[model samples]
Target chain A: MPETNKKVLILSVNDEDKDIVFRPADTLLGVLRGKLGLTGAKPGCLNGDCGACTVLVDGIPMKSCIMLAIEAEGHKVTTIEGLINTKTQASFIKHFAFQCGYCTPGFIMVCHSLAEKQPHADKAVIKEWMQSNICRCTSYQEIEEAVASILAEE
Target chain B: MIPVDFDYYKPESIEEAARLHEQLDRQKMLPLYYSGGTEIITLLRLDLIQTKAVIDIKAIHECREHILGEDYLVLGSSLTLTQIEERNAFPLLTSVSKEIADHTARNKITLGGNICGEIFYREAVLPLLLTDSLFVIGGPQGVKILPAHEAFQQTMQLGRGEFLIQTLTRKDFLGMPYMSVKIRQQWETGYPLVTIAALKAKGEIRAAFSGLCSFPFRSKRMEDELNRKDGTLDVRMDRALRHIPAPVLNDIEGSAEYRLFVLKNTLTDILTVWEVEQNA
Candidate 1:
């Protein structure tokens, strides 16, 4: 703990700013799931290609897998755990936007960010933003319907 | 697949970053500059990047300058792709940046990373290629600004400890009508086999492409030929392709034959856009 103190980071996650220790090259996805015990962001591809580990940094959707935990210092990061009781998560639940539930957190994060950017996101923008979060079970239509519903509510 | 352990440092100034880079190079640690961390993590996981130390340059203020000067726009290297997309300051650039990847990755990927990123899909560079953009490279000797084309082509030519600071492009170029396009067999998220960008500037059509050749480039002569409307559009495209000897990227996303067809289609599509714009 003393040695890792050299890599100590104070990050704002889910409206709570906490001090966390992470390695130099450790990804935010790893730190969220491994150390802090926030398993909301999934580690699907572990590359920027797959958006399964999506989170909101400073209120914008980002792939946590490609972002270093050390780089996340002093930034606001929001995961699916932060989405508890939110309308977007409720929409996902209602529309059955998950099969295995691995990609649900990431999809919810993306939709949440989309709503912030475009409070009433049209179909084109929703279609464009959902491309990164891949749903292997082919539940994309339901997910899109969920996101569109969230937008409609806004 | 975890990347090997590395040390991270965030320098506050360009001089400090350059000094750190030079020091690391002397120690044979193979230091890599990092900003946004999107490319750094992906390449590291793939074992493509084997550096011992990673320097996060986002802390450097000099590299984060995004300003619209009277004549040019100084786009900071650390500006995220999402920031560039939302910046209605450059509408064509906005659309192009949005098409780069998905919204999530865009939030993590930076403009400088996309430009100096060591990847095949440096699609954002196409617009800068069409304009007279120059790169301000910082090193121990000092900050030396080089034309964007020469800097991009001669990245290996950069001296030790040298890195790109920011880009300066004429602000008026952003106002010129341009079309940024990509032909990806896979929908939205696929790396475009051939990303084409063409703009009408100074009363002449200029064009650039990525993924069609070994590197991102443009063809002024091809733009001229496309504008001529001589009965040889198809023949001219074929000849121009052969002139540069465009090499198709034969990868999982596309085959060489498919890439060639995409390049041809992209160039022809630009001509059609040009025709429509000319009439309008």
Candidate 2:
């Protein structure tokens, strides 16, 4: 791979921040999985079609697969693993929102971002926002209900 | 899919980016300038765009400012739809942007990328058409401000390679009603059969319809009929409905006739609402 000293500072919500220099060819996903050992962000559909690799870039949900590591420099990034709250995690278990749990991390990340940005969003808007992430196991109904319940309580 | 090996450069400013483009050999060096990589990544993955260098323009500070001035509203090229929605600077545009897929897609997609890439079923283009927005393009020659419609026309004619710096619209252009109707099997990745935008003011209607032609087209004949003294729009609508060519777009998703019918229905619906608002 061609080499260039492109340093990126990743400020995770957990205070586990790090600054690492990457090559121009490295994607955000590549650096996260290969170097950082943060495997919560699943590598599914490197293209932007599937939102399985969604993450919060500067408080906005984005597909980490398509973004270059260098593009994320000077921006705050929050991944799925960093989204666990004592309350929400308890509610996720109480509501039973996961089936096989493969796509749970992405959903948690997206919902966390949405809740932070728009906690008052209605069910229709939440459904509209969740359309980007596809789940093959048909667990969206439960996921939708859980998200709505959480928002309703808050 | 990983993109082919290429040199990457992030310019510090828009002027520097423009100068970088000017220095490159236009023919020999295929430099692709990108603000956001939502659409460009597809081309890069397919190896359709064989460029020696990819210039990232997000580093330019001027490209990210959203200026709500007294006379005009200027949206920097790199401004994301999410930013626009949060600010509520442009309500109609924000409504349309929210309707598009989800937050993730909106974050990666930029206003300049949407206009420059010319993605079909575009919500921004329709609202822009209704408001008569102008695009500020910075090229090797100099900066040129072209009407939004003319910008799309010129870009569609010449293909892509120009840098869109910002989009500007007059603040006085108010009371314009813009609406979009799309029938999709699924909300995400669902293509619209037809999209119509109507700009009605002072009993005058300037309407445009997409999915009825090669690109979005103004219905001057329909507009004229709406403006006529004895022209009750109910009867004019019947005539206008017929003039809309059938099956303007035929794809796997929908037929041309179906698109025409949707376009007519959409126009009728929006015009009725517009008339009610005008009368109220």
Candidate 3:
């Protein structure tokens, strides 16, 4: 059944459906960081150019800042908080993937998505997939190493 | 940056969606039909475009389905670039899209949005123009199908209450040897300075280029010159390109001279390769 409403109910972390009332302009990033208190997904660029607001929507990594909160109806939304205990998180430290740590959450979510799709993504694949994320810290090589190490472990 | 306030509608069927659009247009509501919403949201936030309402077309199951027919490949317009790339539906599409944006953005950038988008370098559509493709459009007049080249002309030229539904490709296109070369001044995600796509089938060549004009286009004069095969491959290739109308595209990323240089040398190489393969 199709829906016709401004408010959308999304199955958020832990498969809990939450009612999110948003202005037509409210982005998923705003809702996640403001209303839901799921601040794991940082806000930056506001446009799709930056990946700081990336999240998993229905298992697909999408730019939350460019996604309308009202558009996520009936879809599953996962933030960096959902990845706390995951191996990708542990591997981040193991591979020394973070510098200054501002972009770690975004990279974690992307790595989680990549690991789910291709558990053994090589360094080339990791570099290819991570182009969406922009880290001013210039820690990309280490980030790629971290992500590839996790994928290689599988 | 927050977006301007607007209404959102998700209709169940194509007819219902079209009707809603008609009703909205009649009221001068300035409705916009969107599927992936990636470009829509960004443009809205950046104040690049505005609308009073956004109709969610993803609710229609038809827009999400991709069907591989016996003689044709039917790709729902709303299919994301990442989805098509992952499925390897078409080699040209996969190669072009795999490098577009990033992992997450790809999930939200649909085929129709890329083809009909405002910014150029829409390399995905470059290959489609060379092949026998068609656009299935849904509007107030119900469903209508138009050839790919004609549809490309009418795309974004669509009237107030219309949307692209799907794309139809002849299966024989799969047998055509295709090439897509993009010269980007920046990193992987950087916009291409020049995009060239060509298809060789039945001893004929069809080529389309972008980032070289106000919009992407194909050059029949160039194609005819190359197909004539009157002289040496290298000279004919250069002469054919010289026939392209100017001013060829010159943007911040590249100057017109540089675009022509890259296009001439790269296209010549591609044509040379094709000539060798054909003669062999």
Candidate 4:
């Protein structure tokens, strides 16, 4: 029998341990959504251009599609599912930050990290952080408001 | 996701990384060094490159070092663009890197990855070229230090199995008066129409360019023309434009003619800003 290249990856996703078999070529987005059933990170563009698959790796926002599953071995992978009831989520609801709801998870993850990292984020800083994600629905105004409202509370 | 499976090895030291590359080559594994892996992953998705194995060099200590020595600032190749921005060890580098990609993508793009990448618009190398930085490379030939300009032509000219470990810039160069600008086609989110970085050292203006041509470059003739005290800024800029190293790039981002037009304005802006600063 030919030796299989697949290996067991013990991942810490959403503060839980998951041991899943994966190939080295599999992306973090693929493993999270396909293997672990953590489908919150949508695979839009699959390239790094779109932030639909944005997730927090050790509190820093990363595009999951570009990041390999093996790279997430020693780090804490936080998908939108990991985010329970958070201020960014609440602010998104309050501000109506979505039209089609496809980009909300990715935007929420980025905004959530921004709120934690820069609690006093201003307009410039907010724009710098939020520019990574794209919303085809043109809901950037409401998304900006949602992020601004959360940062204001902080 | 990459369509094909490849063996992944994480090497702890430069020697180990080099050895893995050699061994993988002997086994016909077609190994490639991985750091940041943003470009590799992106290109892999498009079927642009193929590899049977990958050596992840991020675990090597020297490749992750970001230190400020008394005489130099040593930045590891694997250090992410975001890390560089947050550290801001070299203000010019920070400014140039800030405009490379959107904020989140910068979190994964690294110094070595940007410089050694197949992507033509290697905007990060502009500041390094202006500073005359040194590259620390490791491979089957062992580690050696080489001047960035000598080893980097259009791309990093590395021997087989070699990879860039770190970049060392003179501490004095870090604080020099500098300007960096990136002009995009439409908005700030996409790739650049033209990106220019300039630094004034010892009463001379040194410049490098990207997106204006197929590859990033620093031309001696262009700098000489720009620095000539005999001509006005407009004349000097026109002369410099004539000496551009290659045909201006014309792609989806911009046309060759439009790129030259934008490059002229950006160069004028740099000169104008620096002129005021120098006089003050």
Using TM-score as the measure, which candidate wins? 4
* Overall local distance difference test of candidate 3: 0.80
| Candidate 3 ranges beyond 4 A from true positions | A1-11
Better of 2 and 4 by TM-score: 4
Task: Give the DockQ of candidate 2.
Answer: 0.44
For model 4, how does the per-residue alpha-carbon lDDT over A1-154 read when each residue is reduced to its tens digit? 1112557988999999999999988899999999999999999998888899999999999999999999999899999998889888889999999999999999999999998999997888899999999999999999988988998898
Per-residue lDDT tens digits of candidate 2, residues A1-154? 1112344445353356776655555677777777687888878877776788887787677888878776776677778767666445555667788887777777777777667767899777787678878787878888887777767776
DockQ of each model vs. true complex: 0.54, 0.44, 0.63, 0.56
List the pairs of residues colliding in candidate 2: B247-B256, B247-B257
Better of 3 and 4 by lDDT: 4
Q: Quick one: best lDDT, which candidate?
A: 4
Choose the strongest candidate by DockQ: 3
Model 1: DockQ score: 0.54
- Tens-digit lDDT string for candidate 1 (B94-150): 867888878778877888888777876677777777887888888889898888778
Q: lDDT of all predictions, in order shown?
A: 0.80, 0.70, 0.80, 0.91
TM-scores across all candidates? 0.93, 0.88, 0.95, 0.98
Candidate 2, which CAPRI tier?
acceptable
Per-residue lDDT of B157 in model 4:
92
